[model samples]
Target: MELTTPTGASILVNLADDFIHGFAKMKVKRIGYGAGQSDMDFPNVLKLYLGEASGRRFNHDEITLLETNIDTATGETMGYLFEQLFEEGALDVVLVPCIMKKNRPGHILKVMCNQADVEQLTALIMEETGTLGVRVMPHAHRLTLSRRIVEKKVVVGDREFKVRFKVAFDSAGVIAFERAEFEDLRRISKKTGLSLRKVREELKS
Candidate 1:
């Protein structure tokens, strides 16, 4: 853009990079932008008009992503892998099922962690499980979190199982999650005389 004064002299500057610099040199009363020609090389570039109003400051930015997939695996092993991730450095770990390549059944393992540790965690998973090379990528983690576990005793014949009900809570403190894994609750119930409902109810009493 070229700015001309009544003196018949003008200044020419590239509006993109020189906008802030030029504005800082002269007194800026306002700043704005108009539709700029799209560049094939840079999808995000845009031109700016600066007359400027505010004082100066700069800022930094960042992004985080967690990704993993498991197809040739089992529920028990997957549970263990999740636990291992938490132990290693993961903030959160979860499993999602999806139909993968060639229409094979699979689980998408999403793990939240710093970018630096993703590789180690992926390597651990590959070493522990017979899975092929892990597929990792950047992803977002929008989590409202809490922790709770309810122990229930389920009876199957003479055996007792100590099953656990895990529920995650949201900011409102309501249970946002509930997972009842026959996770041994049946074993404890059968060994003891207490019923499943009794054990669950005992949590309150």
Candidate 2:
């Protein structure tokens, strides 16, 4: 019975530092698994565990990056693709303008997503841009901070508005950064007849 393939063995050898006979108590953050192709009596799957050991401070994760080059897509097509990708659970999508071969202006579409979403997102990119191939870079390490939304009450002239701000905290529970939601700001600006820049200034003050 072959339990581990060459790739699996190599991963274990390179990644594992210690081995134990019994399980230890820990907090599990996430669980991921890959399906195996075998007709076995038992469930054939390779599972990966992400956990926080005792007294651990920060959180770490891995994500998949998918990129493709598009020279024929119009602005409207790019906008639709962005909406679809985000609706399909993409963590972030960015388009970088570049010059392709023959001095053709193009854009590089980059998508960040979880490993589970790699397939669908790659397909979406191909379908949207008509690209024959999409580059997949899996297991990109990521360090993330804890984030929460805080509601703030702001008085703009005679109007009082409640705005939501996203606050990020470091491992030591100190604030790293805070950003107001742009949609909220845009709405406030439209209603108050103030320019978006003026609204931002009011928030800063």
Candidate 3:
């Protein structure tokens, strides 16, 4: 299928053969069915359901957590590892400073990714960081919010620029939180010769 916007931009979508696909996230409360056209060999019907989801909206999925302690890797090397993990489809990466068993100062790197990407990411960690072993905790469930980015126009000084905002909604369809993207604010501040705080406050107003 193809879709075109007023500005002449286009989007193309291709579906798999012999399969139906849809994307939706909702809570199921009540269900009802309706019968259609009686002349067919198979029953034709439509199912309807209703529900209420309050608080935060989230989806359940399993993820893998990979961790390792590195006392020898340089700060630059660790930074590169972080970039590599993200490039390899890691959901999140975190580093925590710690003291090892031998009283050596070290840092613990934790990587979160989908179960399918575990093998590749784990191998990359070993190859890049040269860690003797990586501990993997599979079957970890996560609840993630549904999020989207919207372009907003903000004025700084005498000029206007488009800024991206992240909007989050709760399960009850209420806006849980909304904030301007930091990168946009930083860029605007540099261009307008304003402090980061001033730019942020101006955008908020």
Candidate 4:
């Protein structure tokens, strides 16, 4: 299948012939349906489900971590590699400075992704960095909080814009913290000609 973005960039994805499958752990609370106009042999409708994560109550599936040490790669090359990894469905990418063999300074590039995308991401890393081999730790368990995005409007100067906040909750459904997205705050600061600190203060109040 081919997917195209708004900027005309395209991505080609292959599917298995036997079955199409995806894994998600969620606690479904409500389900709704929308009817389609097209009449066909089967029901023409769309299903929408709303739910929260199962949280600590259930055993969650593990994610894969791919790591490689690079001593000869340049910073610019690593930066480009990170962008590609994100575009290819990496959950997270981290680069840490460390000392390799022979007391040489280098970086440890770690990538987190699901099992489905491990092969593709690993191949991209190898092709981009020329790393002889990558270390893979499959089935690494992750503890994540349940989170959702909420919008709040803040007035800066004579204009107002909505800022999205990430609200995280505990397993018992209690809110842990809510913080405005940094990119949103930065955009507000640029438009209002205010310091980032000022924008944050205003949002807080």
Candidate 5:
């Protein structure tokens, strides 16, 4: 039987650091099971184990970092450039105000993307900003934690709104931190006439 799908295999290949021959020492913290729709003679469930490992706990991945200095682009042009970069699948983008050569005020545009996207994104940057050169650093190491998004309906005063929370988990399957989606919070605040800070506080309580 074909037990593993292509998507599942791809995820394991990219995310797994190493494959063990047998079980290693582990402090079991949490377990999850997924079942198929049809009932079989034997158990048809996939088991997932989350626990503490003796060595490294955090996940790591490689990414390409692209940076360019823009001294002539206007604020509006930079803003549109950022919007387009994100829409084109940039992992993250940052614009930092800085003093360039000759002490001229400018902004540093930094972009992070998958290694395969370096060529396309670099071209996009040059096309948008008219910059002659971009600094491309490949294979940049990044440490990361397991993360997931959960959605729930939250009631604030007389109104109920749906909100999604971005949750990050540590090595032991414990929640490291979580936060409500900013857009949902902003929507709730606008509808309820509550300040953004107050909306967050209310949601916490």
Candidate 6:
């Protein structure tokens, strides 16, 4: 796809929502919005649909750094660090063996998690290990397709809930889909004498 700017320059892009083998092609249908954080420099909204393009899309970006070297920590101690991090719901944890200053063999522990967990986890690391400090950086969060729906019911006797696409992606990979709220779902189920799952499924359909 190509876009003409006010200056008369053209910008081009190509991407796909998914691949359908042996098919001619799929074109973009629409874009959907999700949400945004108040303090974000970039829009917090999620885009639901992808536009039509001639081919598949690829992307990469530059980034800032956050690193530190620790020489005195032990293997058993490192195990504790990883366990604590995992218990706290860290995104990732790894340790690379390396030779540090004075040619001492050691491990370079790397921990990666959401920006929100950095401060508290860093404090835990400092308190639990010999590392004196941590390096911090402002990072970027990627937007992806996500959605959920719940059944919301009228007080009289209906089950339904609004399903808006969310900015945060769920493991099932839905951008926006339907749902049924419990309160309404329960009442609807009671009124119709149907199981909760059956009521939810019917309402979704």
Model 5 lDDT per residue over 1-205, tens place: 7777899899999999889898867888999999877677889899999987664467778988999999878898999999999988899999999999998899999999998888888898888888899999867998888889999998887788899999988666778789898999999999999999999988988
Error of 3 at 23 (Å): 30
- Score every model by TM-score: 0.40, 0.68, 0.70, 0.67, 0.69, 0.41
Off by over 4 Å in 3: 1-54
Error of 1 at 77 (Å): 0.3
Per-residue C-alpha lDDT of model 6 across residues 1-205, encoded as one tens digit per residue? 2223344332222343444566434476776786744546665565556656433232323232234567777788889988998787666778888889898888776776776677778887887777897876556444334444433333322634332322333444433434345666676677778898886677545
Candidate 1: tens digits of C-alpha lDDT, residues 1-205: 3233344232344323433433354355555554435445444333444553343222222324555567778888888888898999987787889889988888888776777787788787887667676666655534445658877674444454556787767545666667665545454455566796765564444
The digit string of per-residue lDDT tens for model 3 on 41-123 reads 56566576576643466656788898899987889999999999999999999999999988998999999888889889989
lDDT of candidate 1?
0.63
lDDT of 6: 0.60
As for model 3, its CA RMSD to the true structure in angstroms is 12.8
Q: Score each candidate by Cα lDDT.
A: 0.63, 0.88, 0.81, 0.83, 0.88, 0.60
Q: For model 4, which pairs clash? A: none
Worst 10 contiguous positions by lDDT, candidate 5: 51-60
Candidate 3, residue 21: lDDT? 65
Residue-level error in angstroms, candidate 5, position 96: 1.0
Error of 2 at 162 (Å): 0.9
Whole-model alpha-carbon lDDT for candidate 3? 0.81
Show where candidate 4 strays beyond 4 Å. 1-61
Error of 6 at 32 (Å): 27
Q: Candidates 3 and 4: which is better by lDDT? A: 4
